[model samples]
Target: MTDTPGWASPGTAPSNEEREPGASGPTEPADRPGHTPPAPQPGAQPPGPGVKWSKEQPPPGQWSAPTGAPSPQQTPPPPPPGPGWTGQPPGGYGGGYGGPPAGYGGYGAPGGPGAWGGGWGGPPPAAKPGVIPLRPLGVGEILDGAVSTMRTHWRTVLGISLTVALLTEISLVLLQGFVLNDALAQVRVGNRAANPDEVFRALPDMMIGAGIIAVVTTIAVVIATALLTTITSRAVLGRTVSLGEAWRDARPQLPRLFGLILLLGLIVFGVMAGGALPGILVMAVGGDVVAGAGLLVLGLLAASVVTTWLVIRFCLSTPALMLERQSVVKALSRSAKLVRGSWWRTFGIMLLTGLIVRIVQVLIAIPFAVIGAAVSGDGITDLLGTGGGHTGWAYLIIQGIGALIGSALTLPISAGVTVLLYIDQRIRREALDLELARAAGVQASGAGAPGPVPGS
Candidate 1:
């Protein structure tokens, strides 16, 4: 067999038989006469490459051509090139047929990290400045996160809130029954001849009851806040921690949490006491008229300013304490630090959230109040003691129930905002956005690798 210049040997089937070796020899071209038979134009198989044809077939009209090749066909005239074309003639196109079109790498075109890095191929967009790069959180988003947490760990949020609510109601009821009832009954019966003596005698019981309620309620609140905070943090981070797990994480911080509550109560009490002190002194000096008028103006102003400052400073301390696992003092310091430059903004957000929550609480309370009044066999007027029909204790009880309902509904929203505020501060201070994104199960580049070894 004749060998083709580039064809494989005939031992195995050639990639292209048209380029295979001929039967005669390796030296001569396959087209040489007497080496290989000419392929049939109609139905005959063409001889493989390297096989010499008996006679080379001439082109249809190519005798004048040097190698008897076919002459180019002349057909319909071509259209003139458009604006972007460049070639030998307007009709002859070249150069633009292959590769990416012009302006491919420009800003608007599809290339690396196109606007927000959201196009076909590239790394993700850089985070925006000032804004926390967390998943977008609206009221609905926050509510959804809370609901998801509840759904996953219903026993935790519900169990804790319900338990606290029940205990609170029972304690309040018991206070109304045993403690307040005895004191009020004595007052009603005029047992002590002198009002001052009765007041002094009853003060200890009142103070003891108040202290018990405060401590118990504060403990409940601290537990609730910690559980809710940890659960919410896990939820916000898209992690699935159980209520038991959250509670366990929170239990260790109970003392600190209670300290935070105590600190808040003290701040509130101090402000209120300071505001009231001037009135007390004025009364002691000038009696009722001047004292009342002076206290009305000065007390309110002082209270407002102090209350605003306290709220701004301590608004997020509980969540900060819980999440950061800090002592009460540390949590207060952390809160002060976070709120340092943004006190007004933080206050405004808190005020807005409070106003909205208060409105919701009012709405929820109204229906419950109405229901409680109806259940107590008192119309609205009777319930208010304005119809000359005093439902008395019944009215107070109904009102308390209404307050309870309102508190229940407001609790979650208030707790949610507090938790969110802590997260917002972290995101601002630390690069917590990246850590949160990672926690939310977003697979970041090089994220799986261990962090740098110490001292390395």
Candidate 2:
């Protein structure tokens, strides 16, 4: 019972006079540019010459009686469909009820179906549940977040790093005092003897023992770094994870993380090696001259510059490798890529983090050092069993404590930033906010039913 307008009705076509308001209508077919007038339908009424009609005319079902306008009860053409209309065929627009647009069967609509059925462009993706919105973190915010994470999870972060560091330091202490010192003592004693060849004989044994210790320390450092990275990341995100969980997550990344660390170490060593050469040459030349000093300084400066460049280039790769589950080389390459256009910003963040951590370390160490010094009769000598001098066990113990304290305070911050940087990069590169929302137990759009965070 609905009215459909005719193609030739006045409502559809403009009147002839109105079409050519101030000019004559086209007389020749060629005169009209691209427009073609519709041909008359078979048996349809043709316009009489010189006849004209006004613009106003009611649509179908709206005819007026002999001499007046139509009744007001006639409905105007339904206003052009609003913006929400998808322009589907009849019965496709909200099941003909004219409520919301078609296909909207979700909650709160009239009783067409269950509340949650059919996609209604469901609630604008709920703020990723449980994930603290990653507000653009400034240096201060980063520092504060790190501090807070450490304060909250110090037991785990500090405990793990402390245990590892302690084991490392103990091993180092023992190797240096017992193994290396005994070997040196043997060499010294041999030198005192008549046989000069004994020194050479002792050297190989010393070298082998040193090599074993070095390999062990290297392995320990690799393991420790992986653990630290995992712990730091979890802490920074304010997520609780067990030590075993962290270790397991970190284990796979050990090789690449260690490689990155080794790469950094080599860069620093290379710089120092390069710098040492000129200094050594100057010393060999016995130069008190200004040019010799200048050459030595220049070499040192060049080495420092190279070292700084290397540091900045690879600064974020370790965490990137760990968190991204990338190969060492790939992580390094990706990190270099990320840093290509933002080296200075990366450097500044690193420098700021380093400066703050170092200051804290110094503050923590100073009191211990002072206490150790004050307690010993002759400046912490008796404390170490080296009578009345600073060369004894006491100094070692105090230094060890200082190192431990510093590590405890600074380790989390350094680890946290590195991991956060990896996350930040991922967020920037990928729309990782969606992933994070899912991780935080939020129902991300485009994902199916709201579910608990995976792996939780």
Candidate 3:
């Protein structure tokens, strides 16, 4: 009260008896819980540049230091304008980030990045640099990442895919042109009945040609995976990488990767052959046709189930081998570990991604297939090499072009989804998001690295 304050006037303010006891005094502000007002000093001049301001103690649980130190309970104000600071004020308009005020823990530092992916703290922040956001991904995000990577790194992604596809198409064309047409033409020319004996007689030649195709395709798969793996690695960090750079980083792992693919293929072949052996034996003995057919169906079904399980379990091996640079056995073990608890989810993603890839392949291939068929005026069987009519050289050339284009477009999507699945699972199980953030030059609250993911 102006009227009651110890006869209040300019210099002579009211005493506590005449005014509220905790009210601000004329010369100083009120005291806060861990702070004390500094006693008046001679010629202090309000503590200017280069001089330490007098005691303004932080409350308990707060770390105290000079400039650049963080405050305990709030966003620390930015330090004095230094070189390259652009002369903005601290923590305000144009003073903070030119982009979003992302706390290293993700924007606004809200509760530690939502447990690396378990607890839904809303959607994760979109940290750019990579096509995908650097968080555990949703189904949409996974697909988006794949598409975005293709768009952003079209030169590399398309280049690698198309190159591999071209080579693969060439091999296929040669096989169809030179071997398949000739082999089947022989059967047709002889006018032989399509019995088991006849088919078996030609089987050895078929196997030889098939073996050559397998080797070529396997090499193509390895090349594509290696290039895509390196690209994805850089993509995760939101960095752009070149074709040369990807090759440099991935080349060393190719031999081992090829070996791993062959080894796995053999293991799978062995399992399938072993499982289906009883049915094979029944058919070989020429028993009752219905009984043999039923046994064959059962054996095939059982083998299919086993193959699916094994495929899902080791699906991550390619990424593990390339990215982790591990040996074949270690990569298999690593993939198994990543796939252990999340089998169903991984299976679903795999199945869906594969279905999508196949659909795209069909869509792309259909027109070419139609053109090839139309040009030849041959039946469906001739288009696909049945009845030994032999697809003409012209059909081979036309179909090869279509297959090349389809392979070019589809390879990136298929490879990307697989690699992203591996990354997603690691983020879910091993807190890989934090490592990714650091690698991408993002971070968490000045903390060295993010810890384990919750529920991991």
Candidate 4:
């Protein structure tokens, strides 16, 4: 048996201590199907002279002892029977062969015959010192662990998420208010023929503005992911952390993390570009324009498939890098290794998490968008469909506040799921729960639930 319940390492054989009695032990005569013909009755008769008993089948008087009972060496011979003794064994019922010993209760009683019939209960539950139990986790448990981390460490989680969200929202607000406002206003919603030149002129500025916003948002997400990953790891150990502590722990990984994100972005860009390169070449050569368009669409579809596979394969890279202090390349390799056999499962969990986060954002954003449009004298339809003609400071500020709230609530959950998924994968593949158990000071039997580590 393992020291801790359900923490057995892969490939180890179960010990005899974990097996039922007599399962592999030597068998006795009484345990065989047929009876050994009752011990030759006391001196009633003997075989005639020259008659021989077979050696293969021992005589009745020499029958072997019964299984699961005291050996002959342990107990003295029974006393001779008295008048009307009815041939009962010395002790009472169950003193002799197959019957259970007296005082062992009958069918329904504890330690009775029914107990030996094998309904061993399910394996003992794994130790749970913190948000997740120390074993391979289910999808629900993973989600619950993420939420529990956020709820349990709301202070640090909220602080980090809100700070990043506000900074990102502020940058967006400024860019839209100052730079994108005029650029976007130049393009007429209708009459494309008349406003062709205006559209062409505004396209460059609009692209630049959008690119800047993406960069700023990426940076904010990186910081939030790093800090939240650290906090989530600590939370799994039943320990609390502060924003300052989390920042200090995650700061060193930030530069490498940024590099990793950039590397992935470039990879995706290369894939998409490569996918469309052939079609573009066909179009550039001025041959088969329709065919080229068709090829381009097909190429883009293939590229989307490849891109999705790669993203899920490397989704755990962030947590691996942050927690293992691994290089960007090593972290990528680690994620691929962990996700090797479970790609679909990982994809499903991540997709579910994304859907939930998007839902939350929409639920929170629609109200603010509606109110902002109402206050700015723009219709809600315009706000939802087109950006509307006006996005005044009041509208931007209100929208920013709503975004901040949504992000603060959702960022930790996203980061937590990533971190916890990494953990769950390791637990399944590497038997990591044993190490976690030790770190958390869980007892061998998993009954001595210790408090969180003192310095954690």
Best by lDDT: 4
lDDT of 1 by residue, 1-456 (tens): 423322222332212233324333222254544768445698766444443443453333222322122235423324434322222332222212221344333222244343221233433433322122363334444444454556665666676676666667666756665556555443433234537545545544554566566656555555566668877777665555665787789889887776777787787667756776666566556566454546745785788698779768876778878877778888888888888887876776667667976797678767766776776655665444344333445655766676666655555555666677677666556656678766666643432222321211
Worst 10 residues of 1 by lDDT: 90-99
Question: Higher-TM-score candidate among 2 and 3?
Answer: 3
| Candidates arranged by lDDT, highest first | 4, 3, 2, 1
After superposition, candidate 2 runs with Cα above 4 Å error: 1-132, 167-225, 232-238, 285-293, 380-390, 443-456
Deviating ranges (above 4 Å) for candidate 4 = 1-119, 175-218, 276-298, 386-393, 444-456
Clashes of 3: 3
Per-residue lDDT tens digits of candidate 3, residues 258-299?
888888778777776666577667767877655655675677
lDDT of each: 0.57, 0.57, 0.69, 0.71
lDDT of 2 by residue, 1-456 (tens): 123321112233234443444433222233345967778799986543333433443443333331233246643324324422333434233343224655554223644454334343432333423222342334565556566666776777777768876776677656665566545555542134424345444544565576556555444544554576766555534478777888788777776677776776666766756774775576457664445446656776888788778767876777677777888778778788867766786788778888987898788877776676676445743333334212335545675688676766676677666655655555555656567665566545533233332211
Model 3 misplaced stretches (Cα beyond 4 Å): 1-126, 178-219, 377-388, 444-456
lDDT for model 4 comes to: 0.71
Best by TM-score: 4
Instruction: List TM-score per model, in order.
Output: 0.59, 0.56, 0.64, 0.68
The regions of model 1 sitting more than 4 angstroms off are: 1-109, 112-153, 171-223, 377-379, 385-405, 444-456
Residue 285 of candidate 2: its Cα lDDT? 71
- Compute the lDDT of residue 164 as modeled in candidate 3: 94
**lDDT of each residue in 1-456, candidate 4, tens digit only:** 233322222223333444345333212234345757466678776332222322343223332333334444454435434322223354343333444544433223334444332223323456888898887777888889999998898888888899889888888888888888777766636423435545644654665686577667656766677789988887878888898999899889988998998888788767766777776677668877667766766787898799889989988999899989999999999999999999999999989998999899889988987888788655553365355355577787888888888878888888888899999899878878888888888843432223332211
